[model samples]
Target: MVGLGTMGAGIAETLAHRGLAVVGVERDHESLRRARARLAHSLDRAQGHGRLDPPSREDLLARIGLGTDLAAVADCDLVIEAIDERMDAKAALFARLDALCPPGTVLVTNTSSLSVTELAAGTGRPARVLGMHWFNPAPVMGLVEVVRTVVTDPDALEAVVALAGAAGKTAVVAADRAGFIVNALLFGYLNNAVRMVESRFATREDVDAAMRLGCGHPMGPLALLDLIGLDAAQAILASMYEQTGDHRHAPAPLLGQLVAAGLLGRKAGRGFYPYTAPDSGEVVGTGTAVGTGTAVGTGTAAAVEVPPVRRVGVVGSGTMALGIAEVLARSGHEVIVRARRPDAADGVRARVRTSLDAAVAKGRLSEQDRDGALSRLRATTDLGDLGGCDLVLEAVVEDLAVKRELFTDLDKVARPGAVLATTTSSLPVIDCAMATSRPEDVVGMHWFNPAPAMRLVEIVPTVLTGETAIAGALGLARAAGRHPVRCADRAGFIVNALLFPYLNDAVRMVEANYATIDDIDTAMTVGCGHPLGPFALADVVGLDVTLAITRSLYEQFREPAYVPAPLLEHLVRAGFLGRKTGRGFREHRRR
Candidate 1:
């Protein structure tokens, strides 16, 4: 291993612990000493954790050699380059290794963002050069992308893959390109987060929480970028943007600003969030003191007293309405649901009863609790029945006109100062607010599907919305055990705004045939640690829904990146609406 930085040291430790005779090379004795010390610390930690016994750890360390000369690996069978990401430096190192090492020796580079083919072609032995892109904290992360250039020998690729496997890492092979697979998709998402904050769509904390709680991501995009080092992330993103010419891959302007200001994340003790010390994960300051654009209720909702919400009214008899009603009733609120027709109201009540019964059978709800919740919920066709509601949530279809007209009715029936909220995932909440007489009482309470199970609820406030309404919506979300992330009344709000574009990009990738559906999904899952790949998620969300959200984003933003993928439209046109129709980018079994 050449260039013993953190990644190089980790790689050295991984290989040594796997019983491989390894040599770590650095530019000078000081560098080599530092690398050795780092490896020792890591090994000591492993031993303390019982991952390695003392004798085994000593034996492993004994098998490793350190050197400061290129010729030290001349007789070795392999020379893996874990050097800096600069292409000129990598090319120069590879040329020297090609000259000094034996002709049969395979040369591997552990670069994550540079072009492997260009680097390989710089050496006389292009066929022997390959890339082994390992994730950070190499010993901890299981993934190792074995990148093969066009001129790389199949034997050389096989050797690297075998080596990665022997070192107990999951190896994924991809053609040489900027970011290969993981960083390609990963950085685009991260850059979008920066844009979200830069544009003030949401604050850093709320953006991070949306992905963490909403999507099950371990960290939010901005937090992950902070951990990645702002300068390094900007470099990788610049490389991807220059190579792919995709605006989505372009580094957010805020990233460059932060890097220039020396707030390069955990290393600098500050970036998106402030830290108490360098390399410390403990954040010190509140993240509300952000740049330009409205704060969007990120850090904490204001201290205003949330209006009482004992009696709640839900309009429409759709699945969303039933779910919302169930959530409200279970949360100790008297939920009155109004449908357009008596039969529709009856159907809504029946569905809610069935869902509660199933919950009881599954032991998710006790028999008494289920009965109590059912008694609190009532369905009616009379819109006047909602007159006594303290909070009225509209869970109608995703049509602006229909919602506007419903808001006009809700304003008249709901009592004075009643918080009027719309669960519109795609439409603008302001349109509904404008239709109501008291726009200050109209806010958005966008819930993810299966409101009872999903934790995220976007509390969107329009310009006309009041503080009390926002607080009430936030309070109601908390009452139902949901994580409330506040944002402006923008199209797609928090989750859908960030999520749909990614899904569309995945569709574009499949349409371009750059990779198969399985390859893309596997690359994201194995490479980025996403709970599910974009393609799989699109299928689960329904391709039609994905297309509608994508269209909404495009129509709202007018950005080329948000444009709906032709493939998505084609699939929807062909009646392949993902899991609902059992067919989409990938086939799914009918539920």
Candidate 2:
């Protein structure tokens, strides 16, 4: 071990308890003292719990040797470097170890963000050097990213994989990217959440609750952000931005401001929300520090924003449209739904009736509520009926031309200043904006596939779109009992833009045979606390949709990084669309 920090000490102790003698080296004596104390205290607790026998406890403690010299690691077959994430610092340390240790010693850096290739070059031993990126509190975190540079020896890679298993960890080989798998997927979503807060699309509570309740995330993004200090998040974002050059990785302004205020997360008693129990994420303090945009105090912002959505026009003839219409009616809005024809309107009404009836059966909707929802729901094939509506949302096809045509027609026909929005998953909103005379009224209200079931609705606004237009769209979405996240009009918006790439990467992981589907999903759900693994969620979110979004992102960002995996494209081409198609990542039975 290279350093006796929290991660290094945990790894050293884990190895020692596994009956592997560890030469734990630190730059100074004080860190060594702390690490030694931590190891002894940890073993004592384990012994008290009957997890460690007296003989084994003594043997394990005796195996860990504290030293300041890197020369002591020469006899060891494997030496893992757990230290601060500075490229130059890591490179220098690895170079010294390469000079001191035996040629056969597999040298590894516990670097989560630095380049493995650069570190290998610094050591002048490219074949032996690789990245052994471990999660925080190494002994407890089950997943480890075993990063391989081009020159890394296959034997060395296999050795580390076996060693990690021996240490009771599941290792996944990750390409030398900024965050590898978990953090890359995690931090992008976290940054987007901050962007939503910056735009005031919803309150922090709504945002967090939407994710927790709607998406089944272990922790809400805002609360998770507070746990991960702004400075720490900034560092990861900086690395991700350097790698992919996507604006999504660019940390939001509020993150820096909070960090500057010394509210660097739970460690400093605050970040996005004030922490009462520091790292525990329990609310102990009330209110947020006052700022220019939203000065939150007593857990609420001073600006009591009044939204304008008295009447909402819902355009669709599908299940999603009916679900959206149902939610709109349930939220006390007069919902006027438009279909392509009279028969299409009939089908929509029937679907809405069925959905409402089901809700009533589940006791989610009362007899009175269902009847009232039906009363608010009026279906027509004509767009002309939506003239007096406060907001008009077309939940039609996910095509650009069709959406543009609808917005163009709505621009001329709908009442003046009424917000015209499209439920486009991947189409550019600016294209729809340009089609309309009142571009300021055009926005994108992308609810997840199941509008009623999924809690998140990404509210997208182009540069030409007015504040009221944006706010009105979000207001109606929230009024529909949905959590709306405001985002700039981009290719994939927030959720899909950040989500699809990670899914594609998981496919790449599968392509390499890193782990089976069950292993990967298990690691993600059990290890990272995600509600659904990427592959399974990909199945729920159609493969065709994922492909379309990935292609759009690739075209917009011009980052080859966003290209959909060939495997994903193949599945889509094979007509395996997911649960809707009865087959996707895992085969499903047809109804």
Candidate 3:
């Protein structure tokens, strides 16, 4: 192992833990001292956590030999480089190692985004060179991206894969590309988040919260960027943009400005958010924690005083409508669900009962609570029944025309001062508002699917929307135990705006024959700590719905990157909607 920095020390520890003898190298004596201390500290924590016994920790330490000379790696069968992400510096080290090491020794570079093929061309044995990119905190992370150049020998690649498996890490192979598999899909999403913050479309806290609460991501993009040093992020983005020439890969201007100011993430105690000290996880200051306050963007809705909601009306009999009604009823609000037909309304009541019963069975709710919530819910087929509702939420189809027509009817039937909200995910809320005479009363309250479980609710207020309406929607969302984020009436709002584009990029990766579906999914789920890979998530979200959302985003922004992938469109056209149809990027069997 070479360049014993944070990543290097982690990798060295991982290999030594697997019972491999590792010769860890650094630049100088002082640097070598720090590397040894870092390794010891990590092992100490592992031992404290019961992950390693004292004897095993001592044995692992003995397996690692620390030095500051390149000549020491000459006798090693394999040499891995984890140096700084500079092409010139890495190339120089590779050339020097090639001269000193034996002809048959395999060389690996742990680069996140640089070109592996070019690095191989400079070596005396191009076929012996490959990229073995590992995630940070290598001992804990489960992935290692094995990048294979065109000239990389098959035997060398196999040896690396076997080694990774023996070290308890899953290996995914990718062609020599700019970002390879993970960073190619990950950094683009991260850059888009930075652009969202730079444009003031959403606050940094809101962006992170949307992904965490709405999409089930382990960490929000901005916080993850802070954890990854800002300077390092900038370098990766710059490398990706230079290679791909895609403007989306270009680092956002705000990122460049932050780097220029030396606010390089947690290492500097600041980046997107302030930390307690350098290299600390304890964030400082107000409004940095999630769910503390409303994340209102510039020109977006603000929190204001509004009348308390006592009675709520949910329109439609679909899954979303039933889920929303359940949440409202459980929150002590009288819920009236209006369906198009009497049978549909009855179906809504029956489904809610079943869901509540399951919750009771799982000990998530008490029998008394379930009975009380059900008693508070009513179902009807008349629009006139919603006249006395304090707030009416429509969870109808995605068709804009259908929503506009419903708003027209709701305008005549709903009582004055009642908040009218649309649950559209991608359509314009302004269009629905304009269909009603009381445009000031209409606002967008987007709820994620399975509304009773997901806590995110994007509060979108149109230009003509009233402050009373915004406040009412925000208050109601909080009352239902949901996190509300305020943004302007725009296509895709917060979560979908950032999410679908990343899914589209994954589709493009498969379309270009750069990587296989399973490999890409494994890379993301294991490498980035995502709950699901992009393809698996797209399948669960439905390909047709994914296509529609991406189309709406492209129509609104006219961004070429937002254009839906041909493969996705093709699957939708072939009637492979997703898990619903038992087919998508991968096949599924119905239970």
Candidate 4:
């Protein structure tokens, strides 16, 4: 292991733990001392976590030899470089390694974004060069992206893959390209998030919460960017943008400004937000916490007083509508579900009962509670039944015309001062609001799929929307055990606005033949901690729905990168609509 920095020390420790003899090299004696301390601290942490016994940790430490001499690697069979991301510095090191090491010794670079092909061309043995991109805290992360240049020898690649497997890490191969697999898909989303903060479309807290609760992401983009130093993120984005020439990959200006100000991230005690101290995970100040629905950094005025909500009405007969109705009833609100037909109304009751029965069987709900919730829920085909409801939520189809017509009808039938909310994920809330004379009463209340399970509710208010309506929506969402995030009425809102573009970028990767579906999926799931990779998620979401959302985004923003990948469009045209059709990006077993 060369360059004994944080990543280098981690990699060295990982190799030594796998019983491989590692010669760790640093630039100077002082740097070497720091590297040793870092390695020791990491091993102690592992021991504390019960991941390593004292005897095993000592043995692992025994396998590593630390030094500042680069010549010591001459006799090693493999030399891995974990140096800084500068092209000139890495190329110089590779050239020097090629001269000092034996002709047959395999050389590898652990670059996350730089071109592996370019790095290989600087070596005397291009075929012997490849990239073993490991994630941070190498001993814990499960992935290693094995980047193969065109001239990379097959035997050398196989050796690296075998080595990765022996170390208990999964290896995914990708062609030589900027950002390779993970960073190619990841940094673009991160940059878009910074742009969101820069444009003040949403507050930092709301942006992060939208992804965490709405999409099931373990960490939000801004917090992850803070963890990954802003300077490092800027470098990766610059490299990717320079190589791909895609405007979306360009680093957001706010990133450069922060770096210029020396607010690099946790290392500097500040970046997107202030940390409790340098290198600390705890954030300073109470402003960053996710609010129930009040506007903070958002330019919108503070929410008006939340109206009291008791009786609730849910419109539509789809899965979303039934889920919302169930959630409302479970939260102790009287729920009235209005379906278009009696059969659909019956189906809603039947599904809710099944769900409640499952909850009772799982001990999540007591029989008495289930019975009471069921008693509070009423399903009917008559739209007039909703007249007495305090809040009427529309979980109808995504079409603006359908939503507009329904809103017009709802405006007439719902009681005066009733909060009218739409659950449209991509359409403009204002369009639906304008369909009724009571536009001030209409707000966007987007609930994720499987509403009973997901806790996110994006509360979007249009220009004409009343503060009272906003407060009512927030109150209802909070009462139903959901985290309410406020954003302007825009296409895709917060989560989809930031999510689908990354998915589209993944499609473009496969379209360009840069990586296979399995490799790309593995890169994201194992490296970035995404609940599902882009292709797998697209298949689950349905290709048709994914394409429509991307289209809406493109139509709204006109970003070239937001254009739907032709491959995705072709699949949808072929009727490969995803799991629903048993095929999309990959084959699925029908249930």
Instruction: Output the number of the lDDT-best candidate.
Output: 3
Worst 10 residues of 3 by lDDT: 289-298
Task: Show the lowest summed lDDT stretch of 10 residues, model 4.
Answer: 289-298
Q: Which residue pairs collide, candidate 2?
A: 276-284, 287-298
- Candidate 4 CA-lDDT value: 0.89
Model 2 agreement with the true structure over 294-376: per-residue lDDT tens digits: 41211211133545688888887777777888888888999999999888887776788888899899988899988888889
Candidate 4: where is the Cα deviation over 4 Å? 48-50, 53-55, 288-303
Ranking by TM-score: 3, 4, 1, 2
* Local accuracy of candidate 3 as per-residue lDDT tens digits, 91-209: 99999999999999999999998888888899999999999999988999999999999888999999999889988999999999989999999899999988877776778888899
What lDDT score belongs to each candidate, Candidate 1 first?
0.85, 0.79, 0.91, 0.89
lDDT of 3 at 509: 90
Candidate 2 achieves a global lDDT of 0.79
Q: Give per-model CA RMSD.
A: 2.3, 5.4, 2.3, 2.4
Q: Kindly list the per-residue Cα lDDT of model 1 for residues 500-551, writing each as its tens digit.
A: 8778777776676555677678777876788999988988889888998899
Of candidate 2, the 10-residue stretch with the lowest lDDT total is 295-304
